[model samples]
Target: MSALRIALADDQALVRAGLRALLERQGVEIAFEADDGQALLDRLQDTPVDVVLSDIRMPGVDGIAALERLRERGDRTPVLLLTTFDDSELLLRATEAGAQGFLLKDAAPEDLHEAIVRVAGGDTLLQPVSTEPVRARYRYHADDAPRALFSEREVSVLRLMAGGYSNKEIARAMFLAEGTVKNYVSVILEKLDTRDRTRAVLKAITLRVI
Candidate 1:
């Protein structure tokens, strides 16, 4: 198998060097390194790395903003946010901005490596505290009301989404093609006014729509 190509984006030189050393020891290839988010974007335009491990707070175009810009530009490269900021709102915003995974800066090297691999494999990882905030913040609406906006199939997809199933998993579970699942998810996001899957799930649960 080919080694995963990765880009490191952090303002601190020492931190980038340390992470590079650790990933190199694990046989992952460091495609390039950047001092900030803009630099990271510039590198990506030319290099086509497989994944990005970025610090949340950088000088210009912080990690969240960078991910948002990438999504706006239709870049699908996986991004794993490596940062010390574990605030609930920050975590939520990162997910909304299209981050594939999140890890604390103090996580073990093995954990970081695993997170990168998982993200590259199209999985999402979040710190327990970060996930808990998402789960705890779920608000259910009135029980007697009907969900009028969605068809029965769409409602099934939304319930699975609320349970944190990705599009692929939802496709497999519902016996639908992945592209169809993606379309359903896109329609769901549009109807719910959410930027990403996580927020769409939260909003569905809150309004008792799923």
Candidate 2:
């Protein structure tokens, strides 16, 4: 089989060098390297890699911003974000910005390799798929109105949305009427206080609601 071509983008030369060595040992080729998101984009104009591994923070144009620009330019290249910290808000932004996968810089080499391959094969590597962590993030004040809670079915709908299922597809999969699914989505948006389904899902993930 042909080797996987991967690109690295990070302000830290040491980090990129380590990742390059590690990935090369795994039978992957370094397609290119960039120090920031803008440089990555400029390079991508000519070089096409199977996947992009980028640091979440850089001097200019962070990973999330790069992913957004990629989307705006209709670039479907899969991107995996690397972070040095577990910042929930940044994670949410990355998801919303259309990152295919992400990992902490210190993630196991095996896991990192697997994540790159999986994302290249069209899978997302978001964490805490189970809801317990999400539930733990929920906090409410007694004086304030009870935080909006989605029903079991609504949460199911939101999960499908996160998986990129259309409303019609979600309705068919959930075995609910199309109109019912629409209503559920509307309710989900309201509960999450988001303007759209994408934001709703991202916000829900951030709030640990889904």
Candidate 3:
């Protein structure tokens, strides 16, 4: 396969420098870099990279707005969001904006590289740790009501997800195949009417479903 081409959007020059170095070492090409989300979007008009790694808190457009702009124009290029904190509000917004994944700025190089490849290969790469805070932040919305419609097994899968478990980990914990766990996650997301794992967990907490 051709080397993965990536575009980065972050305001901090140092962070971009570090990321460029790390991704370069992994045999990935830096299609371009932008100091803010608008510039990133502008560059994308011509660069046409395989994936986009963007900071959520950029000046002007910001990552969320940039993604929205892309989608508004029918740009389906996968986008991976980067954040400095595991903020639930941001997670929900990013999920709703159709992010392909979430990454903490301090994530290991290997994890970052893996996330890029996974997203490029048409898989969502959400880290449980990144969404745990969203769960806690929205836990206050829990209310006593009739349980949301989810199978017992599905609830078990969601509980593991809230605990920051990946599909592989959830499969091992539940003694099911990884593909089964992925299916369960997809069902949970659909049942909860959320776009991604982080939003699903947050919505589940808000409704006390899990």
Candidate 4:
């Protein structure tokens, strides 16, 4: 695969520098950098990248507000928030605001790289903190979730997908061939009526299907 290109936004110069260094070592190209949310938005208008890593709190428009604006304007690029470990409330807000995933500031370099890759690859949310706050909020009562419509094995595969397992990993865990796992993923997507794993998981959550 070609190198994954990424855009970064953070007010702290030191933090940005450290992250750039770390992410560079992880092999993704840093397309651009912005000091705040407004700046990030402006930069993104002209630059294209596979992912965006942004700080949740900033001087002007914060990360959640920026993500809201991005979705409002129809930008579907996956975004990962940078947060401190105790920012459960902010994390909850980020989830409600449609953030794809997030990274803890104190996470190891490999963990940070994995989070970015998962989000860019359209995987489900890999939350670093407790999702209790998020669960308590944003409870959707959609009747279209098709609860109990999944077969037992499909439910197992869906749970693994929600946990961000790749087809290869799921195949190994389930003692199935990788091709079989791919087939399962296709069926899961079809049953969920979603084109991607991320949306499928979100829909499942909205309907309490898994």
Candidate 5:
């Protein structure tokens, strides 16, 4: 396959320059660059790329707003959000806004590379950020909603799923047969009333269940 094409967006020119160099070193193509979320949206008017790598916070038309507008326009182009901020609420907002993936800006090169590939190839990612704070905040509101209680094991599986692990990896880590993991995942989906893993995990987050 040809190198993966990516559109880069950030307010800091230095950050964009550094990312361009790092991505090029990894055999990734920089299809274009943009200074902010609005620029990213404008570029998308014509340029087509495999993935969109963007910072969460910017002056005008921040990443979340950009993503919302993209989806609002019925554009499902895969978007992977990057940020230096450690705010869990922001992560929730980004994921809910239809970002295919979310990662800290300090993510290792190999990890970043993997995220781009996964998002480009049609996968959602949460990157294992500790959502404890967000969960704590969301719990207050979650209490008012009907809850889907999960077993201890099920919760473990959901966390790993949020980390973007496959069933085989989850089974290996949790020391269970792969089939058993599948059963757990099925139960999770049924409990969350989701038809798929991505929606299950997203719902789990929205409900503060994981």
Candidate 6:
């Protein structure tokens, strides 16, 4: 199999170097490196990479802005956001901006590698603890008026998603086919005006739909 090509974008030189060395040791190719979002965008214009690993908070053109720009320009390369912030609002915004996965900066190297592979394969990855508090915060404020977009089934799926269940697991739990579950998720995303599952769940909670 061909090695996965990846780009590293972070303000810290040491962090970038360590991640590069670690991924290279695992046989993944480092396509390029950038210290900021703008530099990453410039490199992306010329290099064909499978994934981009970016720090959520950078000096200029932060990860969230870069993510929106990438998607706006129709770049399909998967982006995995590494953040030290576990704030639900930040996580929600990152998802809305189109991040494929979210990982804590302190996550194990193996977990990082696994997240990259999963995102490259078109799957969403979210740390469990990272998502729990966000979910709880939403559930705690359940008395607010409901958002007019999601259907009952979609809300159900989003609740399960906030619980960190995979699509297959959700299908099993809800007694629906996996495809049906995926469709519900897709519709939920559209209605919530968000990208990916994590943002959808966060938005649902913020909107008091779940």
List TM-score per model, in order: 0.67, 0.67, 0.76, 0.71, 0.83, 0.73
RMSD values, in order shown: 5.8, 5.8, 4.1, 4.3, 3.0, 4.9
Candidate closest to the true structure, highest TM-score: 5
Global lDDT of each model?
A: 0.80, 0.78, 0.81, 0.80, 0.84, 0.80
Tens digit per residue, CA lDDT, model 3, 50-155 = 9999988887889999999998898999999887674545776676788877888888899889888878877766543344566556554334332358888988
What is the overall TM-score of model 6 with all chains considered together? 0.73
The TM-score that candidate 4 achieves is 0.71
Score candidate 2 by TM-score against the native. 0.67
Please report the TM-score between candidate 5 and the true structure: 0.83
- Report, for all candidates in order, the number of backbone clashes: 0, 1, 0, 0, 0, 0
Per residue, candidate 6 scores C-alpha lDDT tens digits across 20-119 of: 9999998899999999999999999999899999988888799889989999999988999887655444776677678887888888888888878878
Residue 182's lDDT in candidate 1: 95
Estimate, for each residue in 1-210, the C-alpha lDDT of model 4 and write its tens digit: 998999999999999999999888879899999999999998999998999999888988988999999988889889998887566556545766778887778988888888888889886454465445444554555555553377888878877877778888889899999999899888888877778886676566555566
**Cα error of candidate 5 at position 202, Å:** 5.4
Off by over 4 Å in 1: 128-197, 200-210
Per-residue CA lDDT of model 1 for 45-95, tens digit only, reads: 889988999998888789999999999999999999876644454666787
Candidate 6 least-lDDT 10 residues: 138-147
Please estimate how well model 3 matches the true structure, expressed as its whole-model Cα lDDT. 0.81
- With a 3 Å backbone cut-off (N, CA, C), the pairs that clash in candidate 5 are none
Question: How many angstroms is residue 138 displaced in model 1 relative to the true structure, after the best TM-score fit?
Answer: 8.7
